[model samples]
Target chain A: MRLSVFHPVSSLIYFAAVLIATMFCFSPAIQICSVVGALLELFMLESKREFFRNLRFTVVVWLAVAVTNPLFSHKGVTPLFFINGRAFTLEALLYGVMLGGSLSAVIMWFKVFSKVFDRERLLYIFGRKTPKLALIITMTRGFVPKLKAQYRRICDGRKCSGTYMSESRIERLKASCGIFTALCSSTLESAVQTGMSMKARGFGTGKRSFAHSFKFRFGDGVFLFVCILLFSAAMIYSGTGKLRADFYPRIAVSSEPLPMLCFAVLCAIPFILEVKESLKWKFCLAKI
Target chain B: MSKKTFSNLIFLLLIPLLCVAGLLFFRDKLYAWLSVGITVLCCAGYFLHFEGKEIKSAQLAIISAMTALSVFGRMCFAFLPGFKPCTALVIITGMYFGRESGFMTGAMTALISNFYFGQGAWTPFQMLVWGLTGYAAGMLAERLKKSRPTLLIFGAVSGPAFSLIMDLWSCIWADNGFVPPRCRKFFVRLYRNDAGILVSFKEFLCKITENWQVRRAQSR
Candidate 1:
């Protein structure tokens, strides 16, 4: 499914629920589920090349987190080895793996979120909540790219004028500083112009209305309901100790498997939706 | 004192006291939660305080512009390793504008730039550090504006302060508790790179200030 096609509110709810659930749920089973679900969702949503490219970074991060946690946190009973008089335990290693998995899952979910929530949708959501803050966000969003273009122009102009050429470190530094100052002044000047134009346009005088392209539909409602249900169920399961795991003194998992299965299904909802949508599209193409 | 100033004073005082209390009394997870909680409270307090004031479009425009410049500046210097003008720009913003604007700019820069850099738990901590740096500059604006040397010193000092705050977050995250000795290693590593950048930043500010002065003289 094109998650971005959903109403902003529905997408927001889904992401918020999944991301928070992944972060808060520390059990190995839940963490693994989250990681797998996130990876599948990313693969389905992103192009294969893009998915692999992102996967490399996530793997590096996962390895780093997994490695470092075991090194720093030397808790648990089963001593795997002794390094520099510090004991590396099996439980700590497992804990680190879980932490790494959960972290990567969270990161992947955010990547998907960024794809879905483009600048306009973000502005729409924030504008509804706080207009002034939304205006600032919008301005900054527009300003960064403009400033980058300006910086490049400044650099090119300076290079041509030989103002940037200097052998001495201090001279080079001062020249760059001159460029930076010029940039700042120009930026400030343009900001003043923007402010004046906004004032003329009756900005900050009254409540502002935003033109929204998307509206709440039945599909959005259903998506939002599913998200809420999954989130609440996960929370309830976690709260009742059905999803408990301890890795400090010793590694232990909860004997009850029903709640863990439910949690996995909850996490898999997004991936399932995407797969179902893709299959439907494929079938329609075949029929044609 | 007026009620608003009184509350502001109380908030200003309460923050440090709470920090000390959190450090001395709470450790590990509780301290982590407390730090996060305090940051949220301070951000909320600043927002509410700003809401009470009359914010002109000019102020908002300037803040947005400055924040964009700061983020871009950070990107420009990304290759230099620890030599970003974000803190300097934030300080400059605070020196010119009020504290709230500075804080907003700093906080927003952290939030927005992370869209490029990727966000995690560290984002909030970064926001707190940069926001407080801007807030500090705003608080000391009067003294800093008096002399170029003072501004330079503040710029240099803020670099270490920024690194120290970031190091504290890492220390908290890594050890799950603050150990002074463990934190020292991280500080030493950061200080080596950060100090050079900060000193250069001071010189950079000096150059900018000189240019501004010359412009003013010519205009007059």
Candidate 2:
């Protein structure tokens, strides 16, 4: 199994830490590291085609933002050139590039998030906090397809009666609306029965219990601990003014290796895990 | 002078004031963070508010059903891009059930339909805007029900409201044109007004639950 199987909250915490660090910190070093980390991680989890597709998009957005930043912003002292007597500054270009980098980082992270985080994981997270809301959401999600099926049935019946043979587009919309109305009423009617059934079964009477599917193993705990430590260290290290994320008046920064190393390790944690897991699998296959 | 006055001033005046100050200090650098924070907080607050309610199983089922209906409407009308009955259904749910329920239906409709469409950075914003529209419809339910013109006007206006919120977001992120006056006024007023709207939100919830408890007591 991939690192995604390592307790849902562990992955969630790791993702949250990365997001917070990337989001709040505007340093080029971290942003570049993030871009590399994201791309490599995407390559590890997803196919080569998926990796290239994301890379192509990220590069385009990064360049476009970088190029456009100089046009819109005339801040900073160093001007590469002038357009309409407005100074096109190097600092703005760098700032724009970083901005684009961070934006692309966000998109890539979310892409990775979508891959790791499926609907079940989403439900799991919400389910812990607000079971009722999660239940409602689940019911609603399940209900839509059922409603659609009913809508199809209604349309089929309508079609048989020559209702859809309307000569005009407007009439077709009208026919669809009529079907929708029928669907709505029928669903609402069934909703009452569903409610009655739920009432009889005694939902929301007291505290609810669940059969545990996800066990927090020792590895998960260690993973969580390492993530929090690195996140806080990076945050505090940056807070102490050892490293800065400043751009556009001047690209002000100081390179401190420790925090940067911390971030790299944090980002590489999953890549490391995936590699280890794959190697173990290969060894087992060789033995067989 | 009064306690309520001070509270209103804090929420209505001070929060927006602090937001502007933060905007000035950070400049455009933190727009991404700001948007993320806003989206997460708004959705979290909505869900938390939902959890703190006393809802019956029957009510929950109806809410799910209504939410399903709106999403289904959106899917059915996918052939015609601009002509989804999702908004209409949301408004109707709000008008009939109440604002919070309307908000739930609207928010969930956006949330669920996007699963079929595609989830993006814009999903939370869409949820917020649609939910707010349903909420406004709920708040103005009686007036809307009585007056056909008012309902029509609301239908007319809500389309722009969604677009406006989205435009403000895009303008902040993508538009390299640094700082228009209109944008400034809008940003300030929007923060101020939305914060201000929270007071009315509190009042509306109180009115709803108070009536609910009283009606329950009467029946008992």
The TM-score leader among the candidates is 1
For model 2, how does the per-residue alpha-carbon lDDT over A107-212 read when each residue is reduced to its tens digit? 7887788789776777788797788778878899889889878988998998898766476776776677667667766887799899999989988786787654
- For the predicted complex of model 1, DockQ is 0.35
Residues A1-288, model 1: lDDT tens digits: 457789988898888777656765556777788888888888888899999999999999888877766666677899889999988888877777876787788788888888779999988877764566777788998999998888889989989987665777656555666677789889988998999898899877886777878888898998788778767776676666677677768777872677677768867887788888889999999999
What is the lDDT for B180 in model 1?
Answer: 63
What is the Å distance of residue A267 in model 2 from its true position? 1.9
**Stretch of 10 with least lDDT, candidate 1 chain A:** A169-178
Give the per-residue lDDT of model 1 (tens digit) for B1-220. 3447746765787777766644443332345545555676666556555655678898999999999988887776665577778888888788878788888899888888888878765677788788888899899999987898899888888877888887887676544576565576677788688766776677667765676667768979
Report per-candidate DockQ. Answer: 0.35, 0.32
True contacts kept of each: 0.44, 0.57
Query: How does model 2 score on DockQ?
Result: 0.32
